[model samples]
Target: MDIRQYIDSTYLKTPAMAGTTIKENNEVVRSLVNEAVANGYKLVMVRPEMVAFVKRLLCVEKSKVLIGTVIDFPEGEGMLFKKLDEANKSIYDGADELDFVIDYKAFKRRDFEKVKTDVIECTRLCLDHKKIAKWIIEVAALSDKEIISITALVKNVVLTYFSESDYFNVFVKSSTGFYKTESGKPNGATIHSVKLMLENSFPLPVKAAGGIRNYEDAVQMIRLGVKRIGTSSASEIIAGEQVSDEY
Candidate 1:
């Protein structure tokens, strides 16, 4: 299971931690990101408000430490313009990447066109700010048919979203840490979804999120061809713990 070859040298230099909340206090977020940077972690996936603070702290060497934040967030209920505005503001505040949750309600209702439009709009905003956009499809909630359908739509959207990046990324997240009444605990990363996504051969990368806690599961994900992983337990995983990173 040695991933020394697949492991990007920069990845170990700067592991990513998705704070996963737009409502968390700014001071707390700042403290966590600061501590992570001090501990050799390079990237922080924060909410919009904390992006600037992390930027100031991490941008010291003019290297501009990579920063990422969510757009359209855990719940994709905002207007398209609002999402775009938030994305622009985040990038202006020093965010390097944008992770957006495509409106699941719209997708569930089979509003494929709307979903495609949403991706296009969000991607445009990110690119306008020189930021990368990674779509969150919430793959755990989708049925097999829905997965296939959304995958097709996202592939089309990625092609049309931008031409600069030959392949755009769409993450397969389990849950947003909220609205998990049915699953009880957070919806975890699944091998089935990864296999399905791989089988379809989409050009975009798949980031596995929601329940990864330890290096083992992280390694498992890497073996599944998941290029990126989203977890709050990044610190713990780096510490060698087999648990969820949501605390």
Candidate 2:
């Protein structure tokens, strides 16, 4: 399939503590949402506090942007109840979709049951609010075995939620863009994780993120079975800076 048709998912990951500042993250979120809409990007991941502001800013017939706010981003080790409350608030605040991080420690400890329950609760929160839920398995922290296991666990939750809820998302993300080195490439672990998510979950859509700096990488990721490419470089990708000579 041609990669250009794929959507470029993104996030406005302002610091959680930005509310302490004078301008506040909400203003930043509003400005960013307007710019993104003006630029033609449709999906953006936002913080809980910014959800309502972004929804209003991007809600237009010409824009039609969708908001996907993160629950316990970067690290999913927060209390499940707290995450659910955050998700609930985001939905109430007007988020169109929800993206939540799974607790890595739970997965590493082989606590599949805990993982399942947490996701179920999260999904339940979304369902109760009538919103879409996208489970973000931070693939950077898991090993290959752990990745596959988590994928299975997500598949199970997705199936369960779909039967009971509006929709289920099986997006295995690369990284939160929090970890970086001089190389600045998405970790090999994340790549393997995406490969596994795509191979194991054929019918389920995969969202590849992190270190997606160019269009060629985006297209290549789609060829590797990713249905959506999440990156901070959405403008670059849309501007054709990421494409290659052949394209």
Per-residue CA lDDT of model 2 for 122-220, tens digit only, reads 877776666766667766566678777787777767676666324334455545555444454344224567888877654556777676667677777
For candidate 1, give the lDDT of residue 203: 77
Compared with the true structure, what per-residue lDDT tens digits does model 1 show for residues 69-116? 877777786788889889889888988877788787899987767788
TM-scores for all candidates: the values are: 0.81, 0.82
Q: Distance from true position, residue 116, model 2, in Å? A: 0.9
Worst 10 residues of 1 by lDDT: 6-15
Off by over 4 Å in 1: 1-24, 39-42, 61-64, 164-175, 181-186, 245-247
Lowest lDDT 10-residue stretch of candidate 2: 180-189
The model with the greatest TM-score is 2
Candidates in order: C-alpha RMSD to true structure: 5.4, 4.4
Clashes of 2: 2
In TM-score terms, candidate 2 sits at 0.82
Model 1 residue pairs with clashes: 233-245
